[model samples]
Target: MKRTVITVDGNGMLSIPSNLQDLWMSEGELVDMLHVTAMKLHAVIRSIYKDGLLTVSEVQQKQETSNGIWQTLY
Candidate 1:
């Protein structure tokens, strides 16, 4: 996992790092990527709360399932 520190603006908006922003733009639009990322995070949080400490494989499986469901919906 790659990590970077970012600052939120006075209005609570976040500034995407330039490299990450470029990646998102390549895939689609930044807003759409952010929305999908938020949804994935929500799913991960729920899974963690329900199941407790997960292994890497377990987390990846959960993420794949969650992504599949979201893709089906949207």
Candidate 2:
């Protein structure tokens, strides 16, 4: 995993770090991808807040299940 610090401006805008911006541009043309990713991240944060922290194995299991479902649907 990689980590970087970002600041929210007074106007509530966030500037994407340069490294991540490059990856996003290479991946697809859809700007909606960022919104979808943010929503998924919010869901994970909410789950942690409600249920407490998850163990690594528990997180991996959930990820596998999510990927399976996504693959099946796609």
Candidate 3:
């Protein structure tokens, strides 16, 4: 796997590259994600606060993982 650095706009938004957008099934889908980082062969993630902003935070009880795997690669 390879990693690419993408720039976020002043509003912290990124423009998905056309080719990459097509590569991902979740491209246009609504997804709840905490954080994302791609380095070398890894794509790391974790639960995000309901609202993905710096100041606002989600409580601990609300951070537990739910049953089963919502996403996994074969």
Top lDDT model: 1
How does each model score on lDDT? Answer: 0.42, 0.39, 0.30
| RMSD values, in order shown | 14.0, 14.4, 13.0
lDDT of 2: 0.39
TM-score of every candidate: 0.24, 0.25, 0.21
Clashing pairs in model 3, backbone N/Cα/C closer than 3 A: none
Q: What is the lDDT of residue 51 in candidate 3?
A: 37
Looking at model 1, residue 71 earns an lDDT score of: 17
* lDDT (10s digit) by residue, model 2, range 1-74: 23333435667687667674222221111223344564565576468856867643333311123245411100
lDDT of 3 at 64: 19
Q: What does the lDDT read for residue 4 in candidate 2?
A: 32
Model 1 misses residue 36 by how many Å? 19
**Candidate with more favorable, higher lDDT: 1 or 3:** 1
Task: Write the residue-wise lDDT of candidate 3 on 1-74 in tens digits.
Answer: 22222345667687555555222222112132224333311322232332353222221112112574343221
When summed lDDT is taken over every stretch of 10 residues in candidate 2, the lowest stretch is 22-31
A best-first ranking of the candidates according to their TM-score comes to: 2, 1, 3
> Clashing pairs in model 2?
none
